[model samples]
Target: MDNYSVKKLSKLAGVSVRTLHLYDKMGLLKPSVRTEARYRLYGEKELLRLQQILFYRELDFPLKEIGAILDDPAFDIVQALEGHKKALLARRERINTLVGTIEKTLVTLKNNTMLQVEDLYEGISPEKVQAWRTEAMAKWGKETVLEAEENLRSFSKEEMDGLKTELNDNITARLTALMHTDPKGPEVQELIARRYQIILRLTGGQIKMEKLEYFRKLGELYVEDNRYTPVNGMPSMELALFIKEATDHYVSEQKK
Candidate 1:
């Protein structure tokens, strides 16, 4: 049986070596064999197992949840793949709607045209946005709600949409920059610090490490709410996960 080293496997799988190590430590993946020197080696079986793992991760399953799902002896791999296919298709549809909305808005802006109120609400329901505001206020406090609402309401609907789109792009850019960075590296920690600073500014300094962790834990619940998750094409859960992971590393280092 052919076997690949961790480096080779990571390259083939398009994931970081650090991520692979974390997966192994989490028991989400394991090497098929170990050399006399204790080097991990992955064979065909490991590759298939990793494929399933990656698929679940891509579907946004938390590592723990994915571990439980894959560890069950009765787990039907084929059925899971079929289910995943359906989910992926649904996700694609949602992204398409969000992307189309953004594209249309961009077209309007480029032409210096003011969008109609109906067009402003394209791919979004005002009721749902209101519900999001309600939930956010309940969780974060009335003051936080009032601030966000006051700031957001100042923008016209088209302008608000543009702000959301720009924020999304900024998040993606920052995360992508951090993706290849070592979690323990000084550069990455600096980026994390910058992120924490922004968070603090937004929360008016009420969001420290303890409160931040609390918010992070409840984040998935917010994402479960359709009003939050399907906004602007990206799942808010995904953003939450990214922030959680980045901050987890930072906090761990800061304590030490």
Candidate 2:
């Protein structure tokens, strides 16, 4: 098989040699073979893998996640890339909404009209918007409705998706580990505790009773939502099963 040296490959691919070296070190790419002088040579297969890596990197996937995704036999690169394009387009729409909101804010300021938070978000999903409105009414009363609306307007779709992806990956990775071991077992509980800490840290260390309830809801969301399935693959599912057993054990022991 024909092979190109690292320098040659980098030049051909329009990427820096240093970038190629880093990918090699990260195990995201490997040479097809090494010459007698120990120089790296990459072939067609490596080039295709490099293309896959570049595509995922363009979508802002962390290098580590990219590696795991590329290594997965079940991972469909074309399908994933299509999904990423859809996500990017959705983000673009949110940016347009934000721009419109800013324009509205300016007009309100110029006209001396009182601008409320609700006016800031011109577009929000009907279901979530209604839920937020309901929650705001219940918690802060109608008087502070603008405050909740303002907070909702602070995040764009890209920002929200990024946050969700990070959290989902992190929780899935930890939960998958916890599921493998006994939940009643100290080690498993320790893992759960660590996850609890992660949740707290994500919430800026304000893990109050309501926030704990929120965490429970988040877990239920995983069941209600299939978003967890992709990150928590087979191994992760195995881990969840183990964790459930451990939790049962702990509960039964508590009754003793």
Candidate 3:
């Protein structure tokens, strides 16, 4: 097996030597060999581990949690890579949707034209969207509700449709597929954690993911009142319960 010095491996991995040292310090990545001068020497195994580290980092995983995950006894490199592919693909779709929204918003601004209400929310009824505005205005002051509507002006009809597709077809579909898995499992928790941020954005920060009880309450809203039924591609009680239980577990873990 080829062995590389710390500096050499750093250059190869596009990471700083100091970063490698920090990883070593955190017990996240350890070199396999030591030279006569007690210098760090990394092998192929280290290279693969570093690759995994970078992959999780790209997914916004914290370094400490990444270490815990990588060191888990049940960790499987092949499985992890497959999960990474799915997550990255989902993220790419969201990014593409946002970019399209931005482009459309620019065009609308330049033309000084506005999208029709029916087109703004393509799949859903315009009246329903208007009802949502009215309800939001009642719950949270009118200014906040108006500001949230103003933000939606940036999304084109197609981008609005893409957001719906991404949420239902991509995120929800994947979560439904994992419904058979343990809610407390890494895959389930990780997926739900990402979904939490999406929910905050969807609500225009009107619903904060700040408190544990509030966070779990949103999940409860899924099955109880079908409050999120409109946007979540719902009617699956099992999937809704899975999300509720999973988010509850995730919130518990976060507190720890």
Candidate 4:
């Protein structure tokens, strides 16, 4: 029968001899035979076992868990291989997204432009993006969501950065400063108007009739979604709700 010594198996498997020794010590993998000279040798069965071990390792399985899984009497090689294939495909998909994001970033840098918010989230799954769009459409209508997306995509990187800075630094900072004040006070109302203006700037003044309602919904999102709550290094649910209340009052007054 063909066999490989520790050194040979290490070279063939691309695993370190020390790692193989450690596996042996842990009783995770054992040599098929020990030569008279006290050298460990692995036969075909051991090689196949090592391949399984490597596959599990690639999936980030703990060595103990891998050993337990492999040692399970009900374990099926075909099922395990199918699971590995599924995991590898998912990983490849994420890698492809990251690669695309990198390419876009490179182009943006070459053109001296800024990246869009969606660009920052390029590595997120498309399913998640679709889910967000679906939720927004349900609340704000499809036309509003599509228009917002189009408006966001139309901006250059520098323009997006300026808008983001205004929202983060100016609006958020001012809102946080008024957290203890009345949500419907004149000062807070003015800041809410400024917030609406920033959104209009982001949408290039195309918000028109949807401006008040859009800002109101955005404020609700800031309060409801932790993803949108944090700004300028402050992550406070209370602060977000306060902004939502202020925008709600502003929208109500504007309607009269």
Best by lDDT: 4
lDDT of 3 by residue, 123-227 (tens): 566677678657656755677545544555544434444555676777666666665465335664555545555544443334444643455445444424533
lDDT of 4 by residue, 88-189 (tens): 899999999999999888767743432344552344666776686677577656776555555556655555566667777877777766755654467765
Would you list the clashing residue pairs of candidate 2?
179-239, 180-239, 183-246, 184-246
lDDT tens string, model 1, 1-256?
A: 6478999999888888898789888888888788899888898887888888888888776788678787998878678668878988999999999999999787666434322322323456778756755666666566744554333233444544454465456643554455456434555444344444444332234457664554444333433342222323532222333344445555776689
Q: Which one wins on TM-score?
A: 3
Let me know the TM-score candidate 4 reaches against the reference structure.
Answer: 0.35
- Model 1, residue 135: C-alpha shift (Å): 60
> Comparing 2 and 4 by lDDT, which wins?
4
> How does residue 138 of candidate 4 score in lDDT?
76
Please estimate how well model 4 matches the true structure, expressed as its whole-model Cα lDDT.
0.66
Query: What lDDT does each candidate get?
Result: 0.58, 0.58, 0.63, 0.66
Residue 144, model 4: Cα distance from true site in angstroms: 32
State the weakest 10-residue window (summed lDDT) of model 1: 223-232
Give the runs in model 2 whose Cα sits over 4 Å from its true position.
35-38, 59-62, 76-86, 105-256
How do the residues 93-192 of candidate 2 rate in per-residue lDDT, one tens digit apiece?
9999999999877755643431333333335555765676676566546644543334333444344334444546765666566555643455534434
Provide the clashing-pair count of each candidate structure: 0, 4, 0, 1
lDDT head-to-head 2 vs 3, winner: 3
Residue pairs clashing, model 4: 114-157
TM-score for each prediction?
0.32, 0.35, 0.37, 0.35
